[model samples]
Target: MTGKRATQLALLGVVILLVAGLVTGAIGAAITGRDPLLPTPGIHLAPQLITGEARGETTKEVFSTDFVLTNTILSSLITSVLLVGLFWLGTSRLKVVPGRLQSMLELIVEGLLGFMESVIGAARSRSLLPLIATIFLFVLFNAWLGLIPIYQSFGITRWTDLSLTELSKAHVTDVKGKPTITVEDLKHVVEAREAAAISASGKSEAAVEKEAHKFAETNRIEITDAGTIGKQLVVDGNPVTVEGQRYAGKAAEKIQEAGGKVKTAQAGLSAAFLRPAGTDFNMPLALAIISFFFIEILGLRALGLGYLSKFNFIGSLLRFKLIDAFVRFLELVSELVRLLSFTFRLFGNMAAGEILVLLSAFLVPFVITDIVYGLELFVGLIQAVVFAGLTIVFAAVAVAGHEEEGHTAAPEHKQPEHGGGHS
Candidate 1:
């Protein structure tokens, strides 16, 4: 009785000390103006620059790829690698009496396999195990990485600052070591040219100067109205008149030919090449489309062409009647259903997950987003697995007709080591 009492007292003392330590830490954090409980803000993942055209080069807008691919895809890739590496490391050294690591893996895998076997039965489960395992691992890795603080935000950058309108304007690129005609600078050249022509043609000096000034005030360069300033000034060398804007263009070319200069502004070598994360819809769509296609492929490989029949209704008819003729009749619908199902399934889940995370973050500080962060990770993995698994299941069931492989009787379930069999 005494020993029990003492043990309880000791445990109580330790708990009190732990509480005291926590309180002290909290107090210190408050005093330091640091909210230790808050999640750190992730790096921004938006394109900074839409680089405009340069002189001499074609006026092209370069899509800025500052933080998009680097932060999102790179992290996903890393997570995938780690998952593959860990599973590889653990499984490669398998033994009859598993080590602690292997045992832990076996527990997870065994659970998954058991679940799959029950759903798919022995024959199909064995055949689909490898693909299912790969999907499960890839998904889990993507999900787990999404939960990591570093993955969400780190090592960010901006390439340039350019407005949509300004970015659309053409910048000069063909610098010939001489000043060239720019749209704005055309006014000055027109003013000088019109004044000179008027003076040379014997107009009164005051009238000529007044007309030139009038043109300059409005155009700030040349009198380009009708054929006054914009007209061609030379045929080989003797001056004549033609029509249009760009008086300075002719002069600038002449000046360049007669000893003038130009230059090019190059982007810094450190400029980033990947688009910012979430800035565009292409990445997510690509992810959805690719995963969906793969899923169908998985189903096709597992089940056969017969597997793809009844995603809608055509397959049901073809099953009863072997009319390869009717195949095209319902193909559009079948393909659309399969394609849309895969696309929407992924798009809807990802979009929802994204919006939910954003709302949560907006309501609470980033520091408070740990729960959602983990949720996103789970959602990503589940979506990936569900997508791939469904593909395989549909294909397997479709092609094989749910009964009678070569053998007279079904074999004992050879449950997969992953829960990717059907559901």
Candidate 2:
């Protein structure tokens, strides 16, 4: 008892010191206006390209067709391999008395089956188990595996002079001497561009002039709406183009490290090769498309030609019942909108969770971020459950006509026992 009590007290002391240190360190940094231990993370809406000549480039928009492959694509492939390997290992060598992996697999399958049976029916649940179960596992694995340290830490590097919008268009390689731009130089260009925009917006000339002066000590430069000042812009007679937004961050870091010039800086970037698949809009959108088709197909299978009546207003039109036709049209619109709803819902949640964990780590590195990671893990499971649960509910609604909503109670049914013969 004495030794255990001593150990407890020691652990308590360590925790106390940790909290105190974090608080004091944060306070000191705030008061002194110092940079946080970790640099502010850049939030990207689009996944970084990992293949093709444009690899390492990222776009501002979530939807882009220019890239061949991205980090998120690789992450999805990894998730697929993991899911296949895991189930294969669990089922390949089953015994009468199951091993740990087999037991875990059974537990997961049984729980999912029970959940589905509650929503739809025992027979229907068993029939649709493969689709719903695969989605849940895929999403869950993608989220959980992303938390591994290497997913965020290891990746290709980005250089300062490279084209931000499309790496294939970068002119540095074609130019002689690789004429380098400084961080200060980029800052002036950005500020000039902003001042021009503000001036064009009919701001007071004096205010625009003052802003321009603060941005640059030389003659005020004007940037066109197309992001170019003029064709005359050149370094050593080679034309140079700059993306102010990209230069505002990682490029700035490189220039600062290179003593204001990217020519001498070692590469420093944080574009991980394996980001979570959920962070990419494409992944969630693909899943939603699959779910949509499955739901419609299941409805058709159950109701036959009658299922078409849900969206078809032609009968009402023939009867001249305008109100009924309009209402059915609304329902049709709502049904189609579910595709976008599913896509954005999952994408937003996963992206937000990723950002939360990243910002927490940047603001307060170790202990606090670990706590956030735990919360994110719970959130991940919740998202997977929500996604899978909603899919089952929708499937039930599709197959059960309009009466499913009015039915308060799911009918009692016997859960099929997993017999030893299967194992």
Candidate 3:
């Protein structure tokens, strides 16, 4: 087949797949009696250690773990390993004429080095290349990794429950002479149900009784509301299900066995096993800290003790020039502010981009999601470049001493005596 025809055929295949996905998702939602668009995609603010638990238990402790492991940390480690492996593979064998992988690596390094030279000059760029290049590549790779289906769709299960106070605060009314709990109150009920399950599992009486006491503290309410609270659970980064049927927990099972269905409860919060590293505050904050320390160290190494003058407003204050001292203090403050700016810029953009993609995919799966993925790719690269470029600029500025800008020795000039020049 001609190249053009071949390309057209490939495009046709992709279109067919996307259409199939959309149809599948739509049909699934219809059969389930749930609006695919109504549910917000799961995105957790904090990482969860355990995968599953009963939601809404009054017992404060849900799962047992000695240490915390966040999705961000996992992604960072993965990114680091991938980056090292990639560079090693690409450069392991030096070639007179580069292969595709080696050529691509060289092109990227050379382009970035050239850009750094323009900003900070050649000498410093070489010294700073390792830090700058690593930051750029790491951020870019992590952001792109998030766009992959596996990263978004693979995660651990987490169960979250509301506090007793929250349940007590819920509105209640009477239904058929029985105190009826509304849909809102059902979330609080899950806590009791979970405790009961633990008790039924033949745990210590003290353990079960402790949970019972906590449950007792929760004020009871009538089920005046027609609908039951829906329990949200995630397994494997997608909604929990088995054989085309949603997974039912103990509470759900009991209700279903009694010929009833749940219709109005919140899902348990589940943290994905791998989140984009850049989306986490910890990643950017750590990067910012490293950049700030490096910038300071570069200044000190380049200018020695004189580097202190960058923040030394006390000298101006002693000279009785309050305005100059205040201005210098503001400059010092700006240095600290740079840390905040760097952290927020990276974290905010990455996190927001991820959220936007999630929303778009939910609202219009398949086509718009692909488009958003493309946009994220561009955004990720741009963010990485911006971060690396700023680091280089800051390093350059820091190392350019105050004396270099304001004071320099003049070159010696030769002068001849007016009367002796001829002799």
Segments of candidate 1 deviating more than 4 angstroms: 1-71, 159-335, 366-371, 402-423
- Model 3 Cα lDDT, one tens digit per residue, 141-231: 9998888877855643334433323332332223332324444345434455645555656799898778756654544322212111234
User: Least accurate stretch of 10 residues (summed lDDT) in model 3?
Assistant: 409-418
- Give the higher-TM-score candidate: 1 or 2: 2
Candidate 2 lDDT by residue in tens digits, 29-58: 576686344334656667766554354432
lDDT (C-alpha) at residue 19 in model 3: 71
Could you give the candidate ranking by lDDT, starting with the highest? Answer: 2, 3, 1
Q: Each prediction's Cα lDDT score?
A: 0.48, 0.66, 0.66
TM-score of 3: 0.66
| Superposition TM-score, candidate 2 onto the true structure | 0.68
